[model samples]
Target: MTKLQPYEKRPYRPGVGMLLVNDGDLVFVGRRIDQRAEAWQMPQGGIDEGEDARTAAMRELEEEIGTAKAEIVAESRDWIYYDLPPDIADKVWKGQYRGQKQKWFLLRFRGQDSDIRLDTKHQEFDAWRWVPLDQVPALIVPFKQVLYRKVVQEFAPLLARA
Candidate 1:
Protein backbone atom coordinates (compact mmCIF):
# COMPACT_ATOMS: atom_id res chain seq x y z
CA MET A 1 0.00 0.00 0.00
CA THR A 2 1.18 3.49 -0.75
CA LYS A 3 1.50 5.55 2.38
CA LEU A 4 0.12 9.07 2.19
CA GLN A 5 2.66 11.86 2.51
CA PRO A 6 2.72 13.41 5.95
CA TYR A 7 1.22 16.93 5.99
CA GLU A 8 2.74 19.82 7.94
CA LYS A 9 0.67 20.73 10.95
CA ARG A 10 -0.03 24.41 10.29
CA PRO A 11 -2.77 27.05 10.35
CA TYR A 12 -3.22 27.11 6.58
CA ARG A 13 -1.39 26.50 3.33
CA PRO A 14 -2.46 28.80 0.49
CA GLY A 15 -4.75 26.95 -1.95
CA VAL A 16 -7.48 27.43 -4.58
CA GLY A 17 -10.63 25.64 -5.79
CA MET A 18 -12.42 24.05 -8.75
CA LEU A 19 -16.14 24.80 -8.94
CA LEU A 20 -18.03 22.16 -10.92
CA VAL A 21 -21.66 21.83 -11.83
CA ASN A 22 -24.25 19.65 -13.55
CA ASP A 23 -25.85 21.62 -16.40
CA GLY A 24 -28.20 18.85 -17.41
CA ASP A 25 -25.57 17.30 -19.71
CA LEU A 26 -22.19 18.88 -19.01
CA VAL A 27 -19.75 19.82 -16.27
CA PHE A 28 -17.76 23.08 -16.20
CA VAL A 29 -13.99 22.72 -16.39
CA GLY A 30 -11.07 24.98 -17.19
CA ARG A 31 -7.69 24.49 -18.80
CA ARG A 32 -4.55 26.09 -17.39
CA ILE A 33 -2.22 28.46 -19.24
CA ASP A 34 0.23 26.03 -20.81
CA GLN A 35 -0.68 22.55 -21.95
CA ARG A 36 3.04 21.77 -22.11
CA ALA A 37 3.51 22.52 -18.43
CA GLU A 38 1.55 20.61 -15.77
CA ALA A 39 -0.04 23.99 -14.94
CA TRP A 40 -3.43 22.90 -16.17
CA GLN A 41 -5.23 22.30 -12.90
CA MET A 42 -8.50 23.22 -11.24
CA PRO A 43 -8.38 26.78 -9.81
CA GLN A 44 -6.23 26.65 -6.71
CA GLY A 45 -3.57 28.70 -4.83
CA GLY A 46 -2.08 29.45 -1.43
CA ILE A 47 -4.17 30.80 1.46
CA ASP A 48 -3.12 34.18 2.77
CA GLU A 49 -1.79 34.34 6.33
CA GLY A 50 -5.14 35.55 7.66
CA GLU A 51 -7.48 34.09 5.05
CA ASP A 52 -10.24 31.66 5.86
CA ALA A 53 -10.76 28.67 3.57
CA ARG A 54 -14.26 29.62 2.41
CA THR A 55 -13.31 33.26 1.89
CA ALA A 56 -10.15 32.25 0.13
CA ALA A 57 -12.19 29.97 -2.09
CA MET A 58 -14.39 32.87 -3.05
CA ARG A 59 -11.43 35.19 -3.59
CA GLU A 60 -9.64 32.65 -5.76
CA LEU A 61 -12.78 31.91 -7.78
CA GLU A 62 -13.05 35.56 -8.69
CA GLU A 63 -9.34 36.13 -9.21
CA GLU A 64 -8.87 32.99 -11.30
CA ILE A 65 -12.18 32.68 -13.17
CA GLY A 66 -13.79 36.10 -12.78
CA THR A 67 -16.49 34.38 -10.77
CA ALA A 68 -17.95 36.23 -7.84
CA LYS A 69 -20.66 35.38 -5.33
CA ALA A 70 -21.14 31.77 -6.36
CA GLU A 71 -23.32 29.77 -4.03
CA ILE A 72 -21.42 26.84 -2.59
CA VAL A 73 -24.32 24.43 -2.76
CA ALA A 74 -22.16 21.53 -1.72
CA GLU A 75 -18.68 20.74 -0.46
CA SER A 76 -16.68 17.78 0.75
CA ARG A 77 -16.70 17.19 4.48
CA ASP A 78 -13.03 16.27 4.24
CA TRP A 79 -10.09 17.97 2.58
CA ILE A 80 -8.37 16.07 -0.22
CA TYR A 81 -4.61 16.37 -0.43
CA TYR A 82 -1.76 15.58 -2.84
CA ASP A 83 2.00 15.60 -2.66
CA LEU A 84 4.05 18.08 -4.66
CA PRO A 85 6.18 16.62 -7.43
CA PRO A 86 9.74 16.37 -6.06
CA ASP A 87 11.10 18.73 -8.72
CA ILE A 88 9.16 21.74 -7.42
CA ALA A 89 7.84 20.80 -3.98
CA ASP A 90 10.88 21.96 -2.06
CA LYS A 91 10.94 25.34 -3.75
CA VAL A 92 7.15 25.83 -3.78
CA TRP A 93 6.60 25.33 -0.09
CA LYS A 94 9.83 27.04 1.06
CA GLY A 95 9.32 26.13 4.73
CA GLN A 96 5.54 26.43 4.67
CA TYR A 97 2.92 23.69 4.68
CA ARG A 98 4.44 20.57 3.13
CA GLY A 99 1.42 19.98 0.90
CA GLN A 100 -2.03 21.41 0.26
CA LYS A 101 -5.02 19.98 2.08
CA GLN A 102 -7.83 21.25 -0.11
CA LYS A 103 -11.46 21.53 0.84
CA TRP A 104 -13.22 20.88 -2.45
CA PHE A 105 -16.27 23.06 -2.92
CA LEU A 106 -18.91 22.08 -5.49
CA LEU A 107 -20.69 25.18 -6.63
CA ARG A 108 -23.61 25.85 -8.93
CA PHE A 109 -22.87 28.44 -11.59
CA ARG A 110 -25.21 31.36 -11.02
CA GLY A 111 -24.24 33.26 -14.15
CA GLN A 112 -23.55 32.69 -17.82
CA ASP A 113 -20.41 31.12 -19.27
CA SER A 114 -19.21 34.47 -20.55
CA ASP A 115 -18.43 35.54 -17.00
CA ILE A 116 -15.21 33.51 -16.95
CA ARG A 117 -12.10 35.60 -17.46
CA LEU A 118 -8.60 34.52 -18.50
CA ASP A 119 -6.72 37.78 -18.44
CA THR A 120 -4.03 39.78 -16.67
CA LYS A 121 -6.20 40.25 -13.58
CA HIS A 122 -6.23 36.49 -12.95
CA GLN A 123 -4.69 34.13 -15.43
CA GLU A 124 -5.27 30.92 -13.55
CA PHE A 125 -7.31 29.33 -16.35
CA ASP A 126 -6.57 30.28 -19.90
CA ALA A 127 -9.72 28.62 -21.21
CA TRP A 128 -12.96 27.13 -19.96
CA ARG A 129 -15.67 24.76 -21.17
CA TRP A 130 -18.34 22.33 -20.18
CA VAL A 131 -17.58 18.66 -20.60
CA PRO A 132 -18.95 15.35 -19.45
CA LEU A 133 -17.95 15.01 -15.82
CA ASP A 134 -17.17 11.33 -16.31
CA GLN A 135 -14.40 12.30 -18.72
CA VAL A 136 -12.66 14.62 -16.25
CA PRO A 137 -10.72 11.73 -14.80
CA ALA A 138 -8.99 11.23 -18.13
CA LEU A 139 -8.21 14.91 -18.82
CA ILE A 140 -6.55 15.92 -15.57
CA VAL A 141 -2.89 15.29 -14.75
CA PRO A 142 -2.21 11.67 -13.76
CA PHE A 143 -1.30 12.37 -10.15
CA LYS A 144 -4.51 14.30 -9.55
CA GLN A 145 -6.67 11.82 -11.46
CA VAL A 146 -6.83 9.62 -8.37
CA LEU A 147 -8.21 12.38 -6.16
CA TYR A 148 -10.53 13.48 -8.91
CA ARG A 149 -11.99 10.01 -9.07
CA LYS A 150 -12.70 10.05 -5.38
CA VAL A 151 -14.28 13.52 -5.52
CA VAL A 152 -16.49 12.49 -8.43
CA GLN A 153 -17.52 9.28 -6.70
CA GLU A 154 -18.37 11.06 -3.49
CA PHE A 155 -20.37 13.71 -5.32
CA ALA A 156 -21.99 11.39 -7.87
CA PRO A 157 -25.17 11.13 -5.92
CA LEU A 158 -25.53 14.89 -5.69
CA LEU A 159 -25.32 15.27 -9.44
CA ALA A 160 -27.80 12.47 -9.91
CA ARG A 161 -30.23 14.18 -7.59
CA ALA A 162 -29.87 17.42 -9.52
Candidate 2:
Protein backbone atom coordinates (compact mmCIF):
# COMPACT_ATOMS: atom_id res chain seq x y z
CA MET A 1 0.00 0.00 0.00
CA THR A 2 1.18 3.52 -0.69
CA LYS A 3 1.50 6.10 2.02
CA LEU A 4 -1.02 8.91 2.10
CA GLN A 5 0.21 12.48 1.87
CA PRO A 6 -0.71 14.81 4.72
CA TYR A 7 -3.10 16.78 2.61
CA GLU A 8 -4.70 13.61 1.33
CA LYS A 9 -5.48 12.55 4.88
CA ARG A 10 -8.15 15.18 5.33
CA PRO A 11 -11.37 14.50 3.44
CA TYR A 12 -12.89 17.10 1.20
CA ARG A 13 -16.56 17.88 1.54
CA PRO A 14 -18.66 16.86 -1.44
CA GLY A 15 -20.60 19.82 -2.75
CA VAL A 16 -22.25 21.34 -5.79
CA GLY A 17 -22.18 24.86 -7.21
CA MET A 18 -24.49 26.41 -9.76
CA LEU A 19 -23.62 28.91 -12.45
CA LEU A 20 -27.06 30.23 -13.26
CA VAL A 21 -27.04 32.42 -16.34
CA ASN A 22 -29.77 34.72 -17.53
CA ASP A 23 -30.73 35.17 -21.17
CA GLY A 24 -28.19 37.98 -21.31
CA ASP A 25 -25.47 35.46 -20.35
CA LEU A 26 -24.87 37.28 -17.07
CA VAL A 27 -24.18 34.90 -14.20
CA PHE A 28 -25.98 34.97 -10.87
CA VAL A 29 -23.98 35.94 -7.79
CA GLY A 30 -25.15 36.52 -4.27
CA ARG A 31 -23.78 38.55 -1.40
CA ARG A 32 -23.16 36.10 1.42
CA ILE A 33 -25.24 36.88 4.47
CA ASP A 34 -22.52 35.54 6.76
CA GLN A 35 -19.79 37.67 5.25
CA ARG A 36 -19.36 41.35 6.00
CA ALA A 37 -16.85 42.05 3.25
CA GLU A 38 -17.76 42.48 -0.39
CA ALA A 39 -17.89 38.73 -0.71
CA TRP A 40 -20.26 37.36 -3.30
CA GLN A 41 -20.62 33.81 -4.64
CA MET A 42 -22.74 31.60 -6.85
CA PRO A 43 -25.26 29.34 -5.17
CA GLN A 44 -23.50 26.34 -3.62
CA GLY A 45 -24.02 23.87 -0.82
CA GLY A 46 -22.99 20.51 0.59
CA ILE A 47 -24.34 17.28 -0.88
CA ASP A 48 -26.13 15.12 1.57
CA GLU A 49 -25.62 11.36 1.87
CA GLY A 50 -27.05 9.43 -1.09
CA GLU A 51 -27.73 12.63 -3.02
CA ASP A 52 -26.48 12.96 -6.58
CA ALA A 53 -24.53 16.10 -7.49
CA ARG A 54 -27.13 17.33 -9.94
CA THR A 55 -29.95 16.88 -7.44
CA ALA A 56 -27.87 18.62 -4.81
CA ALA A 57 -27.32 21.55 -7.18
CA MET A 58 -31.04 21.93 -7.72
CA ARG A 59 -31.75 21.61 -4.04
CA GLU A 60 -29.15 24.24 -3.25
CA LEU A 61 -30.71 26.63 -5.76
CA GLU A 62 -34.13 26.23 -4.17
CA GLU A 63 -32.68 26.43 -0.68
CA GLU A 64 -30.48 29.44 -1.34
CA ILE A 65 -32.38 31.40 -3.96
CA GLY A 66 -35.87 29.98 -3.49
CA THR A 67 -36.32 28.95 -7.11
CA ALA A 68 -35.78 25.94 -9.32
CA LYS A 69 -36.80 27.47 -12.59
CA ALA A 70 -33.56 26.63 -14.37
CA GLU A 71 -32.26 23.81 -16.51
CA ILE A 72 -28.80 22.35 -16.62
CA VAL A 73 -26.71 23.43 -19.57
CA ALA A 74 -23.52 21.56 -18.76
CA GLU A 75 -21.57 20.08 -15.92
CA SER A 76 -17.88 20.37 -15.17
CA ARG A 77 -16.00 17.47 -16.72
CA ASP A 78 -14.19 16.86 -13.47
CA TRP A 79 -14.52 17.78 -9.83
CA ILE A 80 -13.01 21.16 -8.95
CA TYR A 81 -11.40 21.48 -5.57
CA TYR A 82 -10.75 24.41 -3.24
CA ASP A 83 -9.08 24.55 0.12
CA LEU A 84 -10.40 26.87 2.75
CA PRO A 85 -7.97 29.28 4.35
CA PRO A 86 -6.39 27.82 7.45
CA ASP A 87 -8.06 30.36 9.70
CA ILE A 88 -11.54 29.20 8.72
CA ALA A 89 -10.92 25.59 7.81
CA ASP A 90 -11.19 24.42 11.37
CA LYS A 91 -14.23 26.52 12.00
CA VAL A 92 -16.29 25.17 9.13
CA TRP A 93 -17.64 21.60 8.77
CA LYS A 94 -16.81 21.03 12.42
CA GLY A 95 -13.13 20.60 11.47
CA GLN A 96 -13.91 17.53 9.40
CA TYR A 97 -12.86 18.87 6.05
CA ARG A 98 -10.06 21.02 4.70
CA GLY A 99 -12.08 22.21 1.74
CA GLN A 100 -14.56 21.07 -0.87
CA LYS A 101 -14.45 19.00 -4.03
CA GLN A 102 -17.36 20.29 -6.03
CA LYS A 103 -19.16 19.36 -9.18
CA TRP A 104 -20.32 22.56 -10.84
CA PHE A 105 -23.35 22.85 -13.07
CA LEU A 106 -23.95 25.55 -15.63
CA LEU A 107 -27.62 26.35 -15.76
CA ARG A 108 -29.79 28.52 -17.94
CA PHE A 109 -32.26 30.57 -15.96
CA ARG A 110 -35.75 30.24 -17.40
CA GLY A 111 -37.42 32.49 -14.86
CA GLN A 112 -37.69 36.23 -14.57
CA ASP A 113 -35.82 38.35 -12.02
CA SER A 114 -38.85 38.38 -9.74
CA ASP A 115 -38.58 34.61 -9.45
CA ILE A 116 -35.27 34.92 -7.67
CA ARG A 117 -35.72 35.24 -3.93
CA LEU A 118 -33.14 35.74 -1.20
CA ASP A 119 -35.44 35.18 1.73
CA THR A 120 -35.51 31.40 1.67
CA LYS A 121 -36.16 29.57 4.91
CA HIS A 122 -32.42 28.95 5.28
CA GLN A 123 -31.34 32.26 3.68
CA GLU A 124 -27.67 32.10 2.79
CA PHE A 125 -27.52 35.33 0.79
CA ASP A 126 -28.81 38.78 1.59
CA ALA A 127 -28.56 40.30 -1.89
CA TRP A 128 -27.98 39.06 -5.42
CA ARG A 129 -27.45 40.24 -8.98
CA TRP A 130 -26.58 39.05 -12.43
CA VAL A 131 -23.03 39.93 -13.43
CA PRO A 132 -20.78 39.44 -16.40
CA LEU A 133 -18.82 36.21 -16.14
CA ASP A 134 -15.45 37.95 -16.16
CA GLN A 135 -16.25 39.90 -13.02
CA VAL A 136 -16.94 36.79 -10.99
CA PRO A 137 -13.40 36.14 -9.81
CA ALA A 138 -12.94 39.61 -8.40
CA LEU A 139 -16.27 39.53 -6.59
CA ILE A 140 -15.66 36.39 -4.54
CA VAL A 141 -13.47 35.92 -1.48
CA PRO A 142 -9.74 35.73 -2.17
CA PHE A 143 -9.45 32.11 -1.21
CA LYS A 144 -12.04 31.10 -3.80
CA GLN A 145 -10.77 33.26 -6.68
CA VAL A 146 -8.73 30.51 -8.28
CA LEU A 147 -11.60 28.08 -8.20
CA TYR A 148 -13.95 30.72 -9.60
CA ARG A 149 -11.52 31.46 -12.41
CA LYS A 150 -11.33 27.80 -13.33
CA VAL A 151 -15.10 27.49 -13.35
CA VAL A 152 -15.39 30.55 -15.57
CA GLN A 153 -12.78 29.21 -17.97
CA GLU A 154 -14.40 25.81 -18.16
CA PHE A 155 -17.79 27.23 -19.02
CA ALA A 156 -16.84 30.24 -21.15
CA PRO A 157 -17.47 28.54 -24.47
CA LEU A 158 -20.97 27.39 -23.52
CA LEU A 159 -21.65 30.76 -21.95
CA ALA A 160 -20.61 32.54 -25.14
CA ARG A 161 -23.26 30.62 -27.02
CA ALA A 162 -25.92 31.47 -24.46
Candidate 3:
Protein backbone atom coordinates (compact mmCIF):
# COMPACT_ATOMS: atom_id res chain seq x y z
CA MET A 1 0.00 0.00 0.00
CA THR A 2 1.19 3.54 -0.70
CA LYS A 3 1.99 5.44 2.46
CA LEU A 4 0.08 8.64 3.18
CA GLN A 5 2.04 11.80 2.68
CA PRO A 6 2.12 14.61 5.20
CA TYR A 7 -0.27 17.44 4.56
CA GLU A 8 1.41 20.25 2.68
CA LYS A 9 0.42 23.87 3.04
CA ARG A 10 -1.17 25.29 -0.08
CA PRO A 11 -1.94 28.80 -1.24
CA TYR A 12 -5.62 28.02 -1.76
CA ARG A 13 -8.05 26.07 0.40
CA PRO A 14 -10.60 23.73 -1.13
CA GLY A 15 -14.17 24.99 -0.79
CA VAL A 16 -17.56 25.51 -2.41
CA GLY A 17 -19.91 28.47 -2.87
CA MET A 18 -23.66 28.41 -3.47
CA LEU A 19 -25.65 30.82 -5.59
CA LEU A 20 -29.25 30.04 -4.61
CA VAL A 21 -31.56 31.97 -6.86
CA ASN A 22 -35.31 32.25 -6.42
CA ASP A 23 -38.09 32.39 -9.02
CA GLY A 24 -37.87 36.17 -9.02
CA ASP A 25 -34.17 35.99 -10.00
CA LEU A 26 -33.05 37.19 -6.56
CA VAL A 27 -29.93 35.52 -5.14
CA PHE A 28 -29.37 34.47 -1.53
CA VAL A 29 -26.81 36.38 0.52
CA GLY A 30 -25.86 36.85 4.15
CA ARG A 31 -23.93 39.22 6.36
CA ARG A 32 -20.96 37.44 7.87
CA ILE A 33 -20.89 37.34 11.67
CA ASP A 34 -17.21 38.26 11.78
CA GLN A 35 -17.72 41.51 9.94
CA ARG A 36 -19.56 44.77 10.35
CA ALA A 37 -20.17 47.60 7.87
CA GLU A 38 -20.55 45.85 4.49
CA ALA A 39 -19.60 42.18 4.32
CA TRP A 40 -22.60 40.40 2.87
CA GLN A 41 -21.95 37.23 0.88
CA MET A 42 -23.63 34.11 -0.44
CA PRO A 43 -23.56 30.93 1.65
CA GLN A 44 -20.32 28.92 1.30
CA GLY A 45 -18.05 26.59 3.20
CA GLY A 46 -15.19 24.08 2.93
CA ILE A 47 -15.66 20.84 1.08
CA ASP A 48 -15.28 17.77 3.24
CA GLU A 49 -13.07 14.80 2.46
CA GLY A 50 -14.76 12.27 0.12
CA GLU A 51 -17.38 14.82 -0.89
CA ASP A 52 -18.11 15.77 -4.49
CA ALA A 53 -18.34 19.45 -5.33
CA ARG A 54 -22.07 19.42 -6.01
CA THR A 55 -22.86 17.57 -2.79
CA ALA A 56 -20.48 19.80 -0.92
CA ALA A 57 -22.19 22.88 -2.28
CA MET A 58 -25.59 21.69 -1.11
CA ARG A 59 -24.28 20.57 2.25
CA GLU A 60 -22.60 23.89 2.77
CA LEU A 61 -25.78 25.71 1.87
CA GLU A 62 -27.70 23.82 4.53
CA GLU A 63 -24.89 24.06 7.03
CA GLU A 64 -24.45 27.78 6.64
CA ILE A 65 -28.00 28.91 6.01
CA GLY A 66 -30.15 26.11 7.47
CA THR A 67 -31.97 25.19 4.27
CA ALA A 68 -31.41 22.68 1.45
CA LYS A 69 -34.42 23.37 -0.75
CA ALA A 70 -32.45 24.01 -3.87
CA GLU A 71 -31.70 22.30 -7.16
CA ILE A 72 -28.48 22.58 -9.12
CA VAL A 73 -29.04 24.64 -12.24
CA ALA A 74 -25.48 25.37 -13.36
CA GLU A 75 -21.89 24.82 -12.29
CA SER A 76 -18.63 26.55 -13.10
CA ARG A 77 -16.25 24.28 -15.01
CA ASP A 78 -13.15 25.96 -13.58
CA TRP A 79 -12.19 26.39 -9.95
CA ILE A 80 -12.51 30.00 -8.96
CA TYR A 81 -9.98 31.38 -6.45
CA TYR A 82 -9.71 34.34 -4.10
CA ASP A 83 -6.59 35.54 -2.31
CA LEU A 84 -6.96 36.88 1.20
CA PRO A 85 -5.58 40.33 1.68
CA PRO A 86 -2.76 40.51 4.23
CA ASP A 87 -4.97 42.09 6.86
CA ILE A 88 -7.44 39.21 6.63
CA ALA A 89 -4.96 36.43 5.86
CA ASP A 90 -3.22 37.34 9.08
CA LYS A 91 -6.29 36.42 11.14
CA VAL A 92 -8.53 33.98 9.27
CA TRP A 93 -8.34 30.20 9.58
CA LYS A 94 -5.44 30.47 12.00
CA GLY A 95 -3.42 31.87 9.10
CA GLN A 96 -3.03 28.35 7.76
CA TYR A 97 -4.73 29.18 4.46
CA ARG A 98 -3.68 31.88 1.99
CA GLY A 99 -7.12 31.96 0.37
CA GLN A 100 -9.78 29.68 -1.04
CA LYS A 101 -10.21 27.78 -4.31
CA GLN A 102 -13.93 27.27 -4.84
CA LYS A 103 -16.24 25.28 -7.07
CA TRP A 104 -19.35 27.48 -7.33
CA PHE A 105 -22.84 26.30 -8.20
CA LEU A 106 -26.06 27.94 -9.31
CA LEU A 107 -28.96 26.45 -7.40
CA ARG A 108 -32.65 27.25 -7.81
CA PHE A 109 -34.18 27.94 -4.40
CA ARG A 110 -37.41 25.99 -4.01
CA GLY A 111 -38.53 27.04 -0.56
CA GLN A 112 -40.26 30.20 0.52
CA ASP A 113 -38.21 33.07 2.00
CA SER A 114 -39.49 32.16 5.48
CA ASP A 115 -37.65 28.85 5.33
CA ILE A 116 -34.22 30.45 5.95
CA ARG A 117 -32.80 30.23 9.45
CA LEU A 118 -29.38 31.60 10.38
CA ASP A 119 -29.27 30.27 13.93
CA THR A 120 -27.51 27.09 12.96
CA LYS A 121 -25.40 24.91 15.26
CA HIS A 122 -22.43 26.92 14.04
CA GLN A 123 -23.70 30.23 12.82
CA GLU A 124 -21.63 31.91 10.14
CA PHE A 125 -23.89 34.81 9.29
CA ASP A 126 -25.87 37.38 11.26
CA ALA A 127 -28.55 37.94 8.61
CA TRP A 128 -29.62 36.82 5.15
CA ARG A 129 -31.43 38.23 2.12
CA TRP A 130 -32.37 37.60 -1.50
CA VAL A 131 -30.91 40.32 -3.64
CA PRO A 132 -30.45 41.05 -7.31
CA LEU A 133 -27.63 38.84 -8.65
CA ASP A 134 -25.70 41.80 -10.02
CA GLN A 135 -25.49 43.31 -6.53
CA VAL A 136 -23.54 40.35 -5.11
CA PRO A 137 -19.97 41.38 -5.89
CA ALA A 138 -20.43 44.72 -4.24
CA LEU A 139 -21.90 43.20 -1.07
CA ILE A 140 -19.20 40.55 -0.69
CA VAL A 141 -15.91 41.13 1.05
CA PRO A 142 -13.29 42.66 -1.21
CA PHE A 143 -11.20 39.48 -1.20
CA LYS A 144 -13.99 37.60 -2.91
CA GLN A 145 -14.98 40.38 -5.32
CA VAL A 146 -13.25 38.74 -8.26
CA LEU A 147 -14.72 35.34 -7.51
CA TYR A 148 -18.24 36.75 -7.13
CA ARG A 149 -17.83 38.76 -10.33
CA LYS A 150 -16.98 35.68 -12.36
CA VAL A 151 -19.68 33.66 -10.59
CA VAL A 152 -22.31 36.23 -11.55
CA GLN A 153 -21.13 36.38 -15.13
CA GLU A 154 -21.26 32.62 -15.50
CA PHE A 155 -24.57 32.06 -13.68
CA ALA A 156 -26.38 35.20 -14.81
CA PRO A 157 -27.89 33.33 -17.73
CA LEU A 158 -29.74 30.97 -15.39
CA LEU A 159 -31.28 33.95 -13.65
CA ALA A 160 -32.46 35.37 -16.96
CA ARG A 161 -34.64 32.32 -17.45
CA ALA A 162 -36.47 32.75 -14.15
- What CA RMSD would you report for each candidate? 5.3, 4.0, 4.7
In the range 19-126, model 3's lDDT, one tens digit per residue, is 898888888899989876768999888988889999999888888888899999888889998888765765677666778999998899999888888999999999
- lDDT tens digits, residues 86-128, model 1? 5445455563445567877777667777776768474757777
TM-score of each: 0.79, 0.94, 0.90
Model 2: per-residue lDDT, tens digit, 137-156? Answer: 99999999999999999999
Error of 3 at 40 (Å): 0.1
Which residue pairs in candidate 1 have backbone atoms (N, alpha carbon, C) closer than 3 angstroms, thus clashing?
14-45, 14-46, 14-47, 15-45, 15-46, 15-47, 16-44, 16-45
* Distance from true location, Cα of 92 in model 3, Å: 1.8
Model 3, backbone clash pairs (residues 3+ apart or across chains), number: 0
Per-model CA lDDT versus the true structure? 0.67, 0.92, 0.85
C-alpha lDDT of candidate 1 relative to the true structure? 0.67
Clashing pairs in 3: none
Q: Give the better candidate number (1 or 2) by TM-score.
A: 2
Better of 1 and 3 by lDDT: 3
Alpha-carbon lDDT of model 2: 0.92
**Better TM-score candidate (2, 3):** 2
